[model samples]
Target: MSADQKHFSPPARLLHWLMAPLVVAMLFIGVGMVATLSSWHQTLLAIHKPLGIAILGLVSVRFIVRLTHRTPPLPNDMPRWQQHIAHLSHWVFYALLFAMPLVGWSMLSAGGFPIHLFGPVNLPPIVPQDVQLYALLRSAHTVLALLLFATFLAHLGAALFHGLIRRDGVFSSMAKGRD
Candidate 1:
């Protein structure tokens, strides 16, 4: 890899940092929506739907950026197994990022609920309403969400390992961007 490819492009870095907190917030807000029975439930739902859609949109752009840009390579000293795991984990992240929102949207669609973005804005249904389909989609969403959380934790651990323990430039490639 060339020296110029050692760090992510500015837009890629911007999107990564921008989406990180939002994704974390979405996870917590999802939990809050499920746990609460009061008015907060509705409020959380209100935030959740739009946020999911926003994530979907951003990830789409991010994916395009990923396809076009040259990603930094793993350090030469890193083990082959570590390199494989890193690549696998990234694909998993992409899958979860794209799937989660689509699943949620499909779940709502199956439940015959209009996705109110904000105010009068609403998204049209993506699937025909069916109770069985709704149940299936809901279950899928929950399971995938758990997987997403687990993968996120793994990703975090790996980032910390690179950033702190290894003191490698891998973390900085994304965290600090090109200098």
Candidate 2:
């Protein structure tokens, strides 16, 4: 209800939403690439691998900016429990964002698959093929993706909870920055 609070810095706002589409897109592409195995497999991998790497790079920059820049504090009126949930959810997002790509890369590498980025660049493989480990990592990575989706829903619920019930600008702080 007050007009005195500051909004997120422009860069933080930009990256916040900018990363959303990429994450969702990567999740879909990743699933497609994993579910199919045939002539088209390599083609999909070519597209998916680079895109995942690119997302990882951008998230890295966003994390740095988030740490170094000034983010508007939670509206003072928000409950302490809500603030704690927000903080925990944010860290969870960061972890999943980072883990998904790394695990994918490791899974592929462990399968003796080549990682071809957008062009000539090749990502270094983390391990040699081990049938058992590849299966294990693939399962873990899939579970993490599902967790990301769940956390994402929780994040949305909180945002709506704030923007509607609380009549606060918490959602707007990030949403106001148009992609």
Candidate 3:
């Protein structure tokens, strides 16, 4: 591909930037939810539920964007193993992006909690209510969330390695739409 053509599509870049902050916010919100039982806990819950759903919807669209568009290739001088890792990391990101919300939704459903987005709108339960199932799913959600946070940090570090250290176009392909 031509150097310029190596960049991601405009829509893909936009979605990437947009979701970055939202995902970070969701992680912090989750931490807040667990770290306190104060009155603010409820406020956090109200925000978290809807935000998770929003991420779910956006990720569905993002997945389609990813599949339909060609991503910028890694630097030719980069190691084959690194390229494999990079490709694996992206699929992990997609899997976690889809999993986090679905697991949250299923956990809540098992706990018999409402999936309120706003106003009177509520999502129907995906799994039947069972205390044991709720406990298992809740544990799974926490573990997956921790994994997500670690993955996000790894991605940021990789981006900086490409942008600052390697002087590679990989970061710019997403950050500025050119390498």
Candidate 4:
């Protein structure tokens, strides 16, 4: 493969694809958790907590993989501003990926809620419970979730721009390896 066309390592690609749907689902679940007053609220909460934790774990590994590996470079013909935006957006994504789950977890901790990962797999609280603290963390979590969704949309738009308009390999680099 050409250097610019080099695909992400399999593991990185796997993590990227895996996290995409998961993050989307978590966003929807968060909305559902807040919107519903029925028994389904608890049901959504059950899914949201564990999923956030899972995202946390996967993002940790993804961060490490990102640090240790080399990603394919953007097309040389792309504008410098676009390249800068691409790099900045990537870091923003990484930050959001790490921050969203943490804020959610801490929000629960501050509210004295158990972060039950699964059947009997409860994570310990990172902060002591306080109503005031819970309010702040909960607000932060909601704002960050909104920010994450915006970033996701921007990333998707860029991917489509590259894949469709530019016909560049940028999208395909993560989509698949050179054929």
Candidate 5:
């Protein structure tokens, strides 16, 4: 693709869309996990913890790939405010992507729980078990997840508004492999 033509590198595009659904699932599960009781709740916790770590792994790989690949710039005529918002939102997404998993892992580690990544291999706990700390991190994890969900909605709304109303290629840029 020409430098002037807005487009996503194939890997970036794939990773972007792939993570969208996973992150949404993680957020839903995070919320749902809290409301349940008994074996069902435990099952969701098992899935939520590991799945979140998986998303973190994917986000790390995506970030590295994005760094290695250059994305075309926003349309030259795009307004400064819109451009600023887009940039800020993207960074916030990354921040949450990095923070949520780390907090969860830290919480587990501090709580003296192993991180089981859907495999027999067990991850050693990071922090020594402490009830007070565990409670604090647990709350932090949930709150951050909620914040991330809201930011994600705002991001999606902006993309749709830009793509459908502004008729800009902002949304298309992430999935141009089909377009």
Candidate 6:
């Protein structure tokens, strides 16, 4: 591939850098939400719900951008297994991006709770209310959140490996738009 093709498109990089911190904050916020019984719980819930919806929307757009554009290729010298792992990890990130909010929304729906985004703009429930369903979805959402956090750490480690250790362009492909 040409040098240009070896770098991620501008939009892709923008979405990536934009989402990274938001996702990290969301993870920490999630932990706080579950850890506290104080008044802060409601505060965190308010932030968590809206932020999750935002992530879902952004990820949907990001997925479209990804599909429409060609991504930078993995290094030729990289092991085949590593390449496969890299690809799988990306798909997993996409899956978690899409899954986390939907599950949260569905969990709320199952519990018959309102997803208040702002005044008069609440999200309508997608599932009928059921205590059993609520329990199941709540558990699923927690598990998915944990998985997303793990994947995020692995991705960050890989990027550091390529950038700091290997001195490869893989990290720069996403970190910088050009050579």
What's the candidate order when arranged by decreasing lDDT?
A: 6, 1, 3, 4, 5, 2
Query: Over the stretch 46-100, how does candidate 3's per-residue lDDT look in tens digits?
Result: 9999999889988999999999988888889999999999999999999999999
CA lDDT for candidate 4: 0.91
Scored against the true structure, residue 43 in model 5 reaches a CA lDDT of: 81
Compared with the true structure, all predictions reach lDDT values of 0.93, 0.81, 0.92, 0.91, 0.84, 0.95
lDDT of 6 by residue, 19-53 (tens): 99999999999999999999999999999999999
Candidate 6: C-alpha RMSD after superposition: 0.7
Q: How many pairs of residues in model 5 come into backbone collision?
A: 2
TM-score of 5: 0.91
Off by over 4 Å in 1: none
TM-score of predicted structure 4: 0.96
Mark the 10 consecutive residues where model 4 has the least summed lDDT: 1-10
Candidate 4 regions exceeding 4 Å error are: 1-5
- Cα TM-score per model: 0.97, 0.86, 0.97, 0.96, 0.91, 0.98
* Candidate number of the best lDDT: 6
Model 2 CA RMSD to the hidden true structure, in angstroms = 3.1
| Residue-level error in angstroms, candidate 3, position 55 | 0.7
lDDT of 1 at 107: 96
Q: Per-residue alpha-carbon lDDT of model 4 for 50-123, expressed as tens digits?
A: 89989999999999999988898888999999999999999999999999988888999999998898887999
Scored by TM-score, the top model is 6
Model 3, poorest ten-residue lDDT window? 170-179
Q: Report how far residue 178 has shifted in candidate 6, in Å.
A: 1.2
Tens-place lDDT per residue, model 1, 16-65, is 99999999999999888888899999899999999999999999999999
Report clash pairs, candidate 2.
Answer: none
- Candidate 1 local distance difference test against the native: 0.93
In angstroms, the error of model 6 at 120 is 2.0
